[model samples]
Target chain A: EAGVAQSPRYKIIEKRQSVAFWCNPISGHATLYWYQQILGQGPKLLIQFQNNGVVDDSQLPKDRFSAERLKGVDSTLKIQPAKLEDSAVYLCASGAGAHQETQYFGPGTRLLVL
Target chain B: SQQGEEDPQALSIQEGENATMNCSYKTSINNLQWYRQNSGRGLVHLILIRSNEREKHSGRLRVTLDTSKKSSSLLITASRAADTASYFCATGARGAGNMLTFGGGTRLMVKP
Candidate 1:
């Protein structure tokens, strides 16, 4: 009955540095997601994974941002050459299904890029 | 980009008063959900209303959805200081595999 868990509640990095965040979803949840929430804005979906396969990542910045859900349970999101604008909160959520299910979110990783 | 927009970006009211927040979307959706986010914390799901359903209630929360107008509203009865937080409305578009597009969110401050 544990909720989604994330690591490194906060991070600070310089521009062009690489940063990675980790997420472990709730047990038995098949759908996992990563979202970016900028200050004063709603969360923007960065990528989604159903099991070990990616369901969607249209908004992901392919040039520098990448994520993987290996083994289909825990996932990681990485951003290389981070930009100052990338300073925002990274949230991870897990759902029981891909449709009509409630998504449980983690505390999120707050990344501050200098 | 955000698909939904919330009205009155910020609202302040005394505790024990009703708090109402409205959201409008631009596309077809399967369901609409509301979430509350405390300061520096992740979002917590409040309620979900399907496109076919008009209204739903949980505890002191009431949600109304109007598909024809593509709008929804959330009402918190007898609000408390604990209710102070950012409220967001998210839409699950048809055929989008339940990916949600969230609105900018409404910052509500319930004073005690």
Candidate 2:
């Protein structure tokens, strides 16, 4: 079976610019998530969605970062006015359910802010 | 903040040797999982041990959880060069749905 898919494996933008990443989860998966991984650090959860509805986004930087899973199959994460600190790999993962399930990850988008 | 923290930020070993990595978490968890990430790639789940389980083995990998100390360990026996990667331990905390909090990761290098 195909795994999660993401677009634009790499991206570069100037500070204050806007960048967007897209993710297509595994077929039939019901939960999707976005995570940010800085160099030399583990990925940190940014937002989570369960079939077009957000389950958790408490760690999301609502002031500049936003994500949406409109159809529950694909999702997008956007960062407006990006900062140099935002340079990191953004990963998208999907799971079959919202409990005790394994998460499948995409190749991830590596973003660089100049 | 991350709930799990891995020890020995980096390790180096020759092929056919054994490699061990440890993870400690701060809160109650429903399960702990280990993932491997090759440089510049996404993470791949290795193993998951539930709270009620004490040990699990998958091929060359063995995982042990000690809830009393809130720590878990991953042992990879007869390691190969292909096993060189960053290992991360993630905690699925109670009431957190399916979300996982990952640790800083342990970088393991196995020489062929």
TM-score of 2: 0.98
Q: Measured against the native two-chain assembly using Cα atoms, what DockQ does each of the candidate structures obtain, in the order listed?
A: 0.73, 0.73
Which ten-residue region of model 2 chain B has the weakest summed lDDT? Answer: B91-100
Clashing pairs in 2: none
lDDT for B13 in candidate 1 is 99
True contacts kept of each: 0.71, 0.71
For model 2, how big is the CA root-mean-square deviation? Answer: 1.1
Off by over 4 Å in 1: A97-100
DockQ of 1: 0.73
Q: Candidate 1 on A17-109: residue-level lDDT in tens?
A: 999999999998888999999999999999999889999999999999999998999999999989999999999999865463678899999
lDDT per residue for candidate 2 within A10-109, as digits (tens), equals 9999999999999999998888999999999999999989889999999999999999999889999999989999999999999865473688899999
Model 1: chain A TM-score against the true structure = 0.96
